[model samples]
Target: MFFSPLDQFEIKPLLILNNSYILSLSNYTIYFILVILIIYGYTIIFKNNKLSSNRYGVAIIALYDTILNLVVSQIGRQGGYYFPLIFSIFNIIVISNLLSMIPYSFALSAQLVAVISLSLALWIGNLIIGLYIHGFKFFALFVPSGTPLALVPVLVLIESLSYSSRAISLGLRLSANILSGHLLLLILGSLILSLISTSLIGFIGGIIPVIGVVAIVILEFGISIIQGYVFSILLSGYIKDSILLH
Candidate 1:
């Protein structure tokens, strides 16, 4: 049987709610709920508990410290106020990415629509903050610090385009990386299966692709974590720009 790598991305309905309106629960919804539950459970477990001498507690503390340091370094002391938001974003992305590595699990972050919606929301929120703080002066973002009077309109247009593209670019980067990595894994897996099924000789030869699959899987895991970090860093940078108007 020929397996379609793209089939993994299909959004199949799991439970129908209202057939007339085509309302139904899908894998995405279930996985989203699971993500929420996991986050909630972790918080509940670690919320008020004293940090134990165990490695688990120490690891958690290190992660918390790393995130706090990142926010403070990137967005300054004022960024401390936004630590919860930044932490939530980082955890959600990291968890979703990690969950997608599970066999037969849906990759929520790989969905362009979902990622773009999040990016647009964050981008708009940052815009609102900037405008609220700077009022009309926020529009100054479109004009470079030093430019000829004749180039004002052109520079503003260019700047406006670049600024607006952030949402699309950020989302596209995450979705593209996740989608490609998963697709490559699926292809390699299918190759291994096909080779194994062909003949005894083919089965022996299948070891090569199997090894490739294992290596790629490890690489994908690292990529997933790095992507989450990258997303958080970019958000922090955006927050910095919003606050400093630079």
Candidate 2:
């Protein structure tokens, strides 16, 4: 068995439903459980007495914060209309990432399946939203707001590549950052543990590693929120540009 802190994240089958696939749960169950906890936690945050009220408050705050940040950073004051979608996406991503920090938890953000699903959903959803808002004009997103007529062919090809690449890039951005950070924590911790025995020198070496591990944990916690925010901001920016022709 691996000795890293994250080694406990292995998946175990809960039931074998079929030959090809089995229903299994992962140590990361804690993360998903925390998500449920967060539902109640929000009630506390917003001082809402009822679960329904808390859910509503959570939705409202998430949407407003995400949209407000996107407007300030990427789209300016004119980006207010996109807040609802942006906020929902931001809340989900932020909550998902944060939930992964619990012991034996799986960071679904590290999985391509989870990340790709999220990106694809956002892409398709935004495309639909843009179409709904702009009608046939949404297709115009394929064309740049400004380009020399002669360069339209090259620009179109470039834009197409960029458009398709968004899903992969967005997914990879979160997955890579999360996986690498966790892996680094594991490696450094193991290396420290290996250098010294469990005796005095070992304990001394472990002190440094313990501190390092704590720092890494804290750093990942911060990054979990940041990754979610970045994903939300980018989504908002994309929508703003698509709608405003920026």
Candidate 3:
């Protein structure tokens, strides 16, 4: 049991080694493995030959269509080639966020380090993609059209800072949302426990918080989906900007 709401975020070592904790497994490793297995199972379902013959497969196809449309709309015909990458990103993140809501489960998306690392990698990958395709032309990204001569350097510096900040801000958006939502749920759960365990009057009033908890759970689920979609869209846009100068 957690003594405080923040206690749930504490990392606990799951495996002990011979006097050396430097490489021991932890809760994060276990949960990441679980998430990987879940993603692997989902890929198996996606690969089944008879997938299109069932309702689940139909839904899967619909989701694929949505993603395809998103990629094409944002990145154009070239974007179709990157569908696999975006699909993996969306799946891993959505699954991680959803599975974390399960009781006693570790929330990978809530971890700042993990989220920021992913964002930083994506940002770097985008840079590589841009430079690979356009070479020195990629530097044009920092320049704005119709800029006055005196303001060119100032605008370039400002643009560069804002562009680089996306790596941190993008991941922070998801991590902060997950952390805040989980904190809220924990607080409400504790409140309900205290209320129901109090006097008879408090027990009766506990129903209110129970309902609130249910509502918040539903809201969090919506947020999980929305965050996945938002991440995909923003990533697509970033990739688009990288690939296409100006």
Candidate 4:
């Protein structure tokens, strides 16, 4: 039986908690737990031991340093105060993306609902932080520096709209990238399967797409890492803007 390329994205219930409650165990829930466990394991492994001598430990330490530098550079010295949050976000995202690359594994990052919900929560949290720190002055974010009195209304409207769109855009960007990459892989794999199942000539023709599939998998791994970095950096920028009102 030929399954649809998108079938891999289906969220199947693994165990029903209560039929009436609409809460159940799913592949997503399983993978989500796996992500948390993986992060926790890494933290436990790298906790306070000398890492320079061990190759695996050194690599993990380097990753930590890289993330630390990223947060500090993007958000300034105060960024260290928020280092835990930034580090957690980066690790969770990158790990989840990497897990999705495993064959037959669910891609939590590709779920629009999950990504959008996370984006909205973080965006709202930033707003709350700004409001707590700056009070009414938080609204001043909608006004650019040195705006003429005449264009105040126009610029404020434009800025407000742009600012509000961040939640949608951030989540959409991650979901779109992962969804497209996986879709392409599924299509290519399906095509190769179909071709090889046919005559000898078709099997030979499938080699080209098989090569393309391999290339795309490598590209996808790089993109998965990059998307995590991009998400964290953008969040850092948002945090900085909220604190500095720039």
The TM-score that candidate 4 achieves is 0.93
Candidate 2 lDDT: 0.70
RMSD for each of the candidates: 2.3, 4.7, 1.9, 2.1
Identify the runs in model 1 with alpha carbons over 4 angstroms from their true place.
1-7, 18-23
Q: Residue 152's C-alpha lDDT in candidate 1?
A: 99
Clashes found in each candidate (C-alpha, N, C closer than 3 A): 0, 2, 0, 0
Error of 3 at 236 (Å): 0.9
TM-score of each: 0.92, 0.75, 0.92, 0.93
lDDT of 2 by residue, 92-127 (tens): 667777766765556767777667877887777767
Report the number of the highest-lDDT candidate: 4
Clashes of 1: 0
Q: Which ten residues in a row have the lowest lDDT in candidate 4?
A: 1-10
Question: Relative to the unseen true structure, what is the C-alpha lDDT of residue 58 in candidate 3, on a scale of 0 to 100?
Answer: 85
Which ranges in model 2 have alpha carbons more than 4 Å from their true place? 1-12, 15-37, 40-82
Colliding residue pairs in candidate 3: none
The best candidate in terms of TM-score: 4
Question: In candidate 4, which residue ranges exceed 4 Å CA deviation?
Answer: 1-5, 17-23
User: What does candidate 4 score in Cα RMSD to the true structure?
Assistant: 2.1
